[model samples]
Target chain A: MIRMRDLRKDFSVRVPAGRLRREKRLVSAVDGVSLTIEPGEMVGYIGPNGAGKSTTLKMLTGVLSPTSGEVSVFGLTPVPQRTRLALRIGVVFGQRSQLWWDLPLRESFRLLRHVYQVPPAEHEQRLRRCREMLDLDAFLDTPVRQLSLGQRMRGEITAALLHGPKVLFLDEPTIGLDVVSKQAVRSFLAELGATGAVTVVLTTHDLADIERLCDRLVVIDHGRVVHDGTIEALHARYGSRRSLVVDLDSPLPAGFVLPGTSVAGVEADGHRVTFALDETSAAAAVAGLVAVASVRDLSVVEPDIEDVVARLYRAG
Target chain B: MAETGETWAGETWAGGTRAGAIRAYAALVGGKWRSMLSYRASFAAELLSNVGATVLDVTTVFVLFRATATVGGFTLAEAILMTGLTAFGFVLADLTVGNIDDLKRYVRTGQLDTMLTRPLPVLPQLVFTDLPLRKLLRLVFGAAVYGVALAVNDVPWTAGRVLLAAVAPLGAGLFFGAIFVLTASFAFWWVESGEIGNGFTYGGRDFTSYPITVYAHWFRDLFAYALGFGFVSYQPALALLGRADPLGLPAWAGFVAPLVALPAVAVATLAWRTGIRHYRSTGS
Candidate 1:
């Protein structure tokens, strides 16, 4: 449904090249990226900050025109036929909202009903479904600024879907949400995936979001796509070992071992420890850590896509 | 419904193409209407400020005409008419596009980001999103002041004169609106240029509030030809008052006020498109 050919986006920025003088410099935001997304495919376009993920999304949305290369979505050039393409695509920028901050959430939805030109009956049906699916009824009359981030994001998702867009582009949709809110978003997306009509392109820092929502993963760094395949393929290429970080109350003796887990690294001070464990044994490693030392605090660091991608970059 | 997620990519709207866009514009306008309702205090304050500015403009004219019976061939009555017309232009421009200063805010706050993603054209959407209904109050008050000035002037009101006077304000408004749009479009390339609109938009409008011939020859030439402010408000008023324009412009130039305004609208639109093509999301 979406296709790109040598997609390159360059931004010309002015920098002081000499004293009392500045020169325009062209910086490549997305360089030589060739990608194709099929209909109903949930793809995670993941990257670190300034990794050109947002740039790629902007180009796809036709918000930013590429300096060189071609990009077409649903057989339409996004920049040339942007308005038409917009009717078929919905976008949610998680850090920002498209909802009217002052208006009630329902009013915002009604406004979108016009913006997207959904029929009244269909709009009401979508609103009812959105309210129920996203649990938005409690705050439908509340002003958007008053709604919690979780509720607002759910509202945003509802707003995006009201027109029944064929392609949904989500940028960091799960950022800054509580556990339950994250679960709500993940499950909503999971259900959407089950619907099989919406193709989602999600760009996020949260690998768990990628894991839960996306079947295919595309990783970009420094304006280039480093990996494009299944998450397992990325893992196979760059070792998807989950890590457990624990603050020990005391130093561990040398050669301390936990069965089925390897101490990935131990701080010189011996208070902080990291363990690499299999997906299943990650829970067991934590349980075994209680025996090894008094745990101060611990967290299951998500699949280290960044570290893996960093390694892949170095190796390349 | 029939398995929600697996729809085809090539889906078209069931309704007519323009139906959605037209409805969307209405919704946007209605939403803004309600939002503005919540700012009654600010709205009132803005109305007072408009009235205050008009009072000050009239005071300045009275003070100038006090020193001399006539300033640059404009008697007190004609000068008042000029001030009234310019006030109308100011109200018109501000009502339509005063939020040009807010263009950078839209870009910085990422408002424009989401706006571009919509299926609507960005410029029209921005206009709808930032419609200055508050300024309409200023327009109403300005119209009242304009009506009073027309009455006080006791100017001969032929059908052609009244018709020309009535449409002349719209011409100035269109031209000034184009100025506002053009200045705001500069923010896409140079964000700092956002406030630079004050020069042409305010300065030009203020200059038109009195006789153009009062200014020195160089200044008049600069504003009249270089900036086209003469054709905007002054020329129409000149034609109405039966006075030849400064700088040898024919009196009939006033009838073609849209000629001045249309080219400006065209330029503003072109600048806006160029700006859109160059728009880089804030902070890269």
Candidate 2:
């Protein structure tokens, strides 16, 4: 539902040397990156601090015009018809809220209804659905500023989706939420994607959010998309090394050597041994360790999404 | 989610256009009024403080006028009229355009991103977001003080003059609002120095309160021709008081207050569009 082509956003920043002596330096926030988001696909855009993920999302949502490229949302250029594009897209900034602060949640929703020109019946239906899904009935009458962060985030998400946007751009939507709240938000997004009505692009540092909600991943670093594929594909590509931790009842054998297995480290008392295996079967590695020592307890440590993305960055 | 709950019942709601703009304005004013009502004690104290400060300011002007008796061929009474008229215009500007000063803060902190994504124009939305009801009290206080001063001076008040005097404040408000827009538009390029542009906006009002004749010829020309601030207070009050035009403006120019506001607003709007473009290019 969204397409970006050779997008490049360059900023001319003044290099301040003194009051009278300064020069302009061009910095590219997003450099020659392009991607397409299909309908009902929840894609996670991951990157380090200044990797231009937020810039890319802003261009797609009509909030920022790309400097030297084109962004089309559902076949319309976002820059040329921003107001009309606003109707079809919804955005939520995790750090900021669009709701009126002093007003009650219901009042904010009503104001949004008027602003979006939502029909009365559809507005009512949407409110009902949103309240049920976001669990907003508990504090619907409370002022938004008085709400807890989790509750306020729920309100923000509800407000963004109230217009039934064809696409939703969530910038760090689950940041700073508690564990339960994060899971709730992630599950809600998963259910929304399951409905197949809207495309979702989530930019967040939280790896669990990606693992829980997004099936496809786009890893960007230094203003470029370094990797783009399914979660399993990313894991398979950069997540081959596995760590094996074995707790032995007795000390390891002297000069023990297992084929394709190297000792990573030895913990206290030399009873716990850690091994790094390269493209080796987990069962075979366990058997090799068991054969060399009396195993008490053992576990395989598979790399999570965080380690995989971190590895990609480190490799780059 | 209650079906029977209804807020903003009688307020007219619109997102754009002149009529719709008026409706949105009223809604904003109503919202501010309700907020002020919620803190009655604080509101009363704020009103009293405003009155005290205004009285002190007027007393200073009165003392100066008693000493000089006339300035630039304007008698003490004419000077009072000019002062009162300018004060009224200044307060009206504050009431209407005060939010524009806050616009830079919003933009710098990424609050403007929320505003831009909304369905309404960013300008009108920011205006409606905060109405500044305290300044509205100042507006009433200014008009009342001006009315009393005009009565005490025994200036002949015709219906046309009264209408022009009334409309002058609104025109001045729009003029100041346009300046604020122009100032806030600088945030796109000079993000950290948004407040530097405020020197022109608030400083222009300070220069308008006194007769423009007192300043040097270059400064007077700057305010009149370059800034067009003289049309905001000086010319309108001159026409209302049956005085000769200052700055050699045409005698009938006061009737074109709305037209004068049109170009300032148009230019400010263009500047704002350009600023948004720059912001998009810069991406922060």
lDDT measured at residue B106 in model 1 versus the true structure, 0 to 100: 81
lDDT of 1 at B197: 72
Residue A33 lDDT in model 1? 98
lDDT of 1 at B263: 86
* Candidate 2 lDDT by residue in tens digits, A140-188: 9998879989999999998987766777899999889998788778887
CA lDDT scores, all candidates in order: 0.81, 0.76
The clash count for each model shown is 11, 0
Residue B208 error, candidate 1, Å: 1.1
The sequence of per-residue lDDT tens digits that candidate 1 reaches over residues A33-111 is: 9999998899998877888988889889878888889999988888888888888898998877899988889999888
Q: Write the per-residue lDDT of candidate 2 for residues B106-213, one digit (tens) a residue.
A: 767778788777656777777766766655567777788678767766545888777887787777777877888888888776677656877988688767666777
Sorted into a CAPRI-style docking class, model 1 comes out as acceptable
lDDT digits (tens) for residues B1-284 of candidate 1: 46343222224574337765777787788898888777778877876776676677668888988899998887888888878887887788777677776888887665688888888888778888878776666777778767877787756667878888788888788888898888888888887775577787778887888778888989988987787887776777767777776557776787776478888899999999999888887543
Model 2: chain A TM-score against the true structure: 0.94
